[model samples]
Target: MLKVNTENSVRYKGKPKKTSVNAGRLKLIERNKEKPDVARIEKPTTILRGMRLIDPNEVNKNMICSNCRKQLAFNHIVEEKTTGFHHIWTMKCDTCFTLTKCHSSKSHFNDGHLYYDANTAAVLGAVHSGAGCNALRKIAMRIDMPVLSQETYKRYEREIGSLIEEAAKDSCQGAAAEEQNLVVEHIDTLRDKL
Candidate 1:
């Protein structure tokens, strides 16, 4: 049923004997092999064609460390191609390394690609300032900047419109409070005069 060699190696029925290599030596060899790959960070093995470059420092500034509440340090950009191609910027906290900022260059809702530049922000601002989609489309014709489609613009508005409305309502509430205080002061003065 089983065969035993002179070296005490066992072989099962019709099965070849298993060869053993020292686990420690195998791990050492693997570590040696990985060193060169780790050293060559300039030439990343995973390369993405037509990947857009974004300012790492700008992204770092926007990211906050979840652990220490400090700014996150930009580590690198990685391109992912699952449903669609997208660039993800990886960041981590320098002090504790507890916080991670994994930002994607594509909208999660499939509205469009990420836009960080002032020109794109300005176009979005115009939309936020009550400009209609048709008007923005006409403006896009006059300008060289790529304007988002009316459908995409509507999606963007739907995604962030609640936040904008909340901020506006907060501002209005503060203004109303101030106005109420001023009116109460005037009423008090009038009562004193009476």
Candidate 2:
């Protein structure tokens, strides 16, 4: 067995241990330690520019900032068409740089490819409300909005169905376990009475 007390010391079987620091190396390290440049220090405000403003409506045309309640100006128009069309009017609040999006209608935007974006919350709402794919399609058609394929609606249904099934199973298991504990206690009390 071998024991070494120095941090730089190393030992091997049947070999002598060596530990030393070169004087020239220490001088070289000291010479290379330079102070950071004062000019390179970043201003904190530069980072704040990348943050999103509190009011999203500030991006729309002639809209008031939802936060500051100040009138905003139209920045520009973002028009694009894929399945349908989109004419998005952008506005910004000069005070806080809050952006807001303005569309022609809440149901549909300027004949865009799709009627609504159908975010997670909206899709889950439709599933919970029992709105079938055909019903959704009919509603879109009635509103003159571009309708998505039945497959998309089916996919949403499947996703929501699985989540519901999982929650139901978990609840059933929890109830069963609680009931079993209660039944065991009741049986024990009846046996004592006998």
Question: Which has the greatest lDDT?
Answer: 1
Error of 2 at 68 (Å): 20
lDDT of 1: 0.54
Q: Which ranges of candidate 1 are over 4 A from the true structure?
A: 1-123, 192-194
TM-score of each: 0.38, 0.37
The sequence of per-residue lDDT tens digits that candidate 1 reaches over residues 36-145 is 65556666444334333344555455567667787654342232322112234445466766635444332343446455442344345765677767776566555543
Q: What value does the lDDT take at residue 110 in candidate 2? A: 33
Superposed Cα deviation of residue 173, candidate 2 (Å)? 1.4
State in Å the error of residue 127, model 2.
2.6
Decoy 1 TM-score against native = 0.38
Clashing pairs in 1: none
C-alpha RMSD of each candidate structure in angstroms: 16.5, 24.0
